[model samples]
Target: MAESIPSDSPAVADDHHGHEEPSFWSKYVFSTDHKMIAMQYMFTGMAMAVIGGFMAYAFRMQLAFPGIEVPGFGIVTPANYNALVTNHGAIMIFWVAMPVLIAAFGNYLIPLMCGCDDMVFPKLNRLSYQIFLLSAVVLLSSFFVEGGGFGGAWTAYPPLSAKAEYSLTPLGSSIWLGAVALEFVAFLLGGINFITTAMNSRAPGMKLYDIPIVIWMIVIASILFLVSVGPLIAGAIMLLFDQQLGTAFFDPARGGDPVLWQHLFWFFGHPEVYVVLLPALGITAEIITVFARKKLFGYKTVLHTTIATGVLSFTVWAHHQFISGVDPRMAHVFTLTTLLISVPIAEMMFVYIATLYGGSIRLTTPMLWGLSFIAEFLIGGVTGIFLGASGADIYFHDTYFVLAHFHYTFFPIAIIGTFAGLTFWFPKMFGRMMNDRLGKIHFWGTIIPFNFIFIPLFVLGMGGQHRRIFDYSYFPELSMPWMQDIRVLATSSLLIMLGFQVVFFYNFIVSLRSGEKASKNPWKSNTLEWTADSPPPHGNWKELPTVYRGPYEYSVPGRDEDYWPQDQPN
Candidate 1:
C-alpha cells in the first residue's frame, strides 16, 4: 500500500519522527527502495553491456580480420563467431537495453514522477530484479554448454533453433530459451507495478494531465509489454518443449510450422521496439522541454499519438515476414501499416523541433544527447521506410542496411537517450553535480564515432553485403579488395566510441563522492520530484506535493523566474 503523508508536513523538510539509520545491507542490498533498486538495475545493466559489447567486438574483429587471435578468445572459429553474433544481439536487447532503459528508469522515476513514496508492490519490484539477475546468470552459462552458445540468429528461427539435431547444440539452445523466458517473467511483474502505481497511487488533486509525460509513457509502455509478451512467452515455452522434450512445435518434419514461430516472435517483437523506445522518448521529451525553456507543444496530441503508435505497432509485425513466404496480399497490408506508423513518430519529432524554436536553449550535456537522439532516430526512421515496403525489402532483406537501420534506432534510444536522462538526473539521483565539461566531451566522442561506424554500413549494405557472414573474401562477387576497408572502419569506430564511455563512467563515479552538492530543485523545473530533497528520503517526501499546474511551465510573461514548479500554489 502507498504510505499516507501527514497533513502538516512540508514537501521538502525531513524528520517528522525519529528512526534509526539502516545498515549498509538493509539500505543498499536486498532493499525495496525504488531508487536503490534503480541503481542496482543501472549497474547490472552496465555489466551486461560489457558482456554484450565484448561479443560485438569479437565478431567485428572476426569480420575485419578473419582468424585473428583476440587476447582472451584466441582465433575466432566459425562456431565461435556465430555465438558472438547471436549473444551480442540477444544480450544487448534483452539484458542490457531493456533492463537499463525500461526496468531501471521505470522503477526509479515512475513513483517519483507520479508523486508516490515507493512502488505499491515493493516486494514484487525487488523480486523482479532478483529474478532478472538469475536470468542473466543463466544466459551467461549457455556459453559453456555442449556445442557452444546457440547461434540461430537473435530471431532464433526454427527448424534451426527448434531441432538440436540440425542446430547441433542441445543444452546451450535450451538454456538460452529458458533465460529469455525468465526475463519475460521479470518484466511482466515489473510492468504490473508500473501500471498500478501510476493509476492508483498518484498524489491527491493531480489530474491525469498533471502527470509528467515520462510517467505516462512508462505506464503505456508497461501496458504494451504486458499485452504483447503473452504470445512470445507461449512461443518460447513451446520451442523449449520441442528442444528438450521433442514436442516439435516448430519442426516441419513433425508437422510444425516455422513461419508460425516468426509470427509469434515478431508479434511481440514489433511492439517490443517501442517497449524499449518510448521511455527514452519520454526522457528526451523532459530534457528538451526543460533545456528549451518552453511548454511541450501539443501535449494532448502527443499523448494520443503515443497510444495510437502502440496500437499501430501491433499491426506491422508481419513486415518482417514479407520475404518469409507469407501471402503477398497480407504483405501489402503489413507494409501499409508499417509506413503509416511513422506519422505519429514524425509528429512527435517536429513538436520537439518546434518547442526549441526561439526558446532559451541551454546547450547542456543532456540536451546534446537529446538532440543526438532526434538526429540519429530521424535517420533510423527514414531508412526503415525502405525495409517497410515489400518491393524494397526483397533487395535489402538481410543486408547491413537493416543492421544499420536498427542500430541507429536502438543505439540512440538505449545509449544516447539513456545518457541524456543519466546526466540530466545525476544531481537528482546522487545529490551532487556531474562534471558538465567532461559530459560534453563524452557526448561528442560517442556520437561522432557512432555515425562513422553505422553510416558506412549503409554503403556496404548497398554493395550487397549480407549480415552474419563470418568471411566475405571467399566470394568472388563480393571480392572488392577496397570493400574490406569499410569493415575495418566500422570496427575502428566501435573501439573509439567504447573508449569515450570510460570517461562517462569515470565522471559518473567520481562525481558521486567529490562533486558539488545539489540544492533542492537544481534545474528549477516544474515537477513534484523536484519539490523533495535532491536525493529524496526513503519515503521520497515528508508530505506529498500538492499539484498546482502542469510539469512544463516555463517562460510565461510577468513571471519573475522563467520556471514555475508544479508544487507552487497557482
Candidate 2:
C-alpha cells in the first residue's frame, strides 16, 4: 500500500520550507525537538557517568589499599568511603542508566521507529528532561551540605536512614530522598509521553506487530516503570517525613515496621532491574538481526517472553529478603519465584543465540557488544541461581560475591548495552560513521580488563569477603594476604577498564567533527529511522514514511537487495 511521495507532499518538503528558523536558545536549550532533547539527556548522562566512575575509582582504591592516600581523593575516611559507595550506586542507576537508556533513547527512537514526526506531547518531553536535570543538581548539592551525603547505602533502610543521629547526615539524607523523588516524577512524565506517542502516533497502516522490537521494548519498560514506581514513591515520602518531620513510619521504637521499607523498596527495585534491562535486550535484538542479515528468529515469541519476564519480575522481589528475617515458608515461595523468573530470561538469551545461528555475521563493534552482553549476562544469571536459593543466600548475602554478580549484570546492561546502541545509532544521530577500529580497540580494552576485575571479586566472595566493610585489614578473617591480593587485582583491573573509556570519548569527538559522511542507510537497516536522512532534519522526514512491511525484512527471496525498508513498497 505504500507509494512514493510526490514532490509537493509535506513529507518530502524541507522542514524549514515554510517556517521561521528557530533561535539558538530555543533550538539548543529549550528545544521541543525530540532529537535535541535526546541530545540533552545523552550528554547529561555521560557527565553523570564520569562522576559515578570517579566515585568508583575513589572507593575501590580505598578497598584495595585500605588507607593509602588515593590520588584525586586524598585519604578515604570511613565516612567518605561510605558516601562514595552510596552515591556511586545512586548516581549510576538513577542518573546515568535510567536517563541514558530510557529518556534519551526513548525520546529519539520512539517517534522515528514508530514512523511519526514527533511525540504526541512534545512539551511534556522537554519538561521531563528539565526536571531530571534539576534532580541531578539536587543530588550533587547534597554532598556539599552539612555532614556530607547520606551513608546508609543506596537502599536507605530505616533506623539508619530515618534517624539523623544514626545516619549523621540529617540534611543530606532528606536531600537525597528529595532528589530521588524528583527523578521519579521526571520519568513519570516522560513515560506517559513514550506510551502515548507509540500508542497513538504511528504512521497509517502500521499495526502492532509492525512496530520495531526496540519500540516495543521501550514501551514495555515505560509501562513497567509506571506500574512499579508508585510504591517506591510512597515509601520515599514516608522516609523523608521520618528524616525531617519526626515521623516514625519506619522507626521500630515508635511502633513502626522497619521491614515495610524493604518490601516497598524491593518491590520497585527488583523490577527496576528489568525496567532498565528490557531496553538493552531490545537494543541487542535490533543489532543482531541487522548484522546477521536475518529476520528475527521468532518475533512474537520474543515479545511474549518479554511480557512474561516483566510479570515474573514483580513476584520475585522478596528473594532479596531471604536473610532479612522473612519467614521460612515465605522465603521458600520467593525462592521458587526467583528461580522461576530465570526461565523466561534464559529463553530470551537462547533466542538471541538462535537469531545469530547460521547467519552471515558482521563482527562490528556494536555486534561485539551485543554478543558480549549475551555471554557475560549468562554468567551473571548463572551465579544468581546460587544466591536465589534461600539456603545459599544465607551465606552469600552482603558479600563480595553479591557485589560481583551485581556488576556482571549491571555492567553488561548499562555500559556495554549503551555502547552497543550508541555506536549502532551514531551514524543516524549524526551524519557520520564512527571509527570501527577505534571502537573495537575500546571494546577489547574494556571487555578483557572487565573480566579480570570481576572474576577476582567472585573468588573473594566465595572466600567470604563482606561487602560493607571499608577496611578488611582490621578484620583478621578477611585480612589474609590472598584475599587482599584479590582485592588489589580487582581494583587494578577497574583502573584499566576506566582508562580505556578515554578511547571511546576520543573516538566520539573525532567522529562528530571529521569522520566519513554517512549515507542514509549506512548499515542497510530496515527500520523507519534508517529511511530518513542521517542526522534527520528537525521534522525527521522530508515526507513522512509509510510502512509497507515489518522492520526486519532482510533477505527476502527474488529481491536484489538483501534488506527491505519498512517504508518501501513492493
Task: State the lDDT of candidate 1 residue by residue for 2-25, as single tens digits.
Answer: 346542332211223223687888
Q: Relative to the true structure, how large is the alpha-carbon lDDT of every model?
A: 0.88, 0.91
Per-residue lDDT tens digits for candidate 2, residues 1-570, read 123544344223112322468889988998878899998999999999999999999999998998999999899998898899999999999998899999999999998898778776676778899999999999999999999998889999998999989999989999999999999999999999899889888987788999998889999999999999999999999999898899989999889999999999999999999989988899999999999998998999899999999899989999999889867789999889999989998998888999987788999999999999999999999999989999899999999899999899999989988999999999999999999999999999999999999999989889888887899878898899988888899899999999999999999999999999999989999999998889998888878888988888898889999999888888
CA RMSD, predictions in order: 3.9, 4.3
Name model 1 segments beyond 4 Å from true: 1-19
What's the TM-score of each model vs. the native?
0.96, 0.96
Off by over 4 Å in 2: 1-18
Give the distance in Å from residue 202's predicted Cα in candidate 2 to where it truly belongs.
0.9
Backbone clash count for every predicted candidate, in the order shown: 0, 4
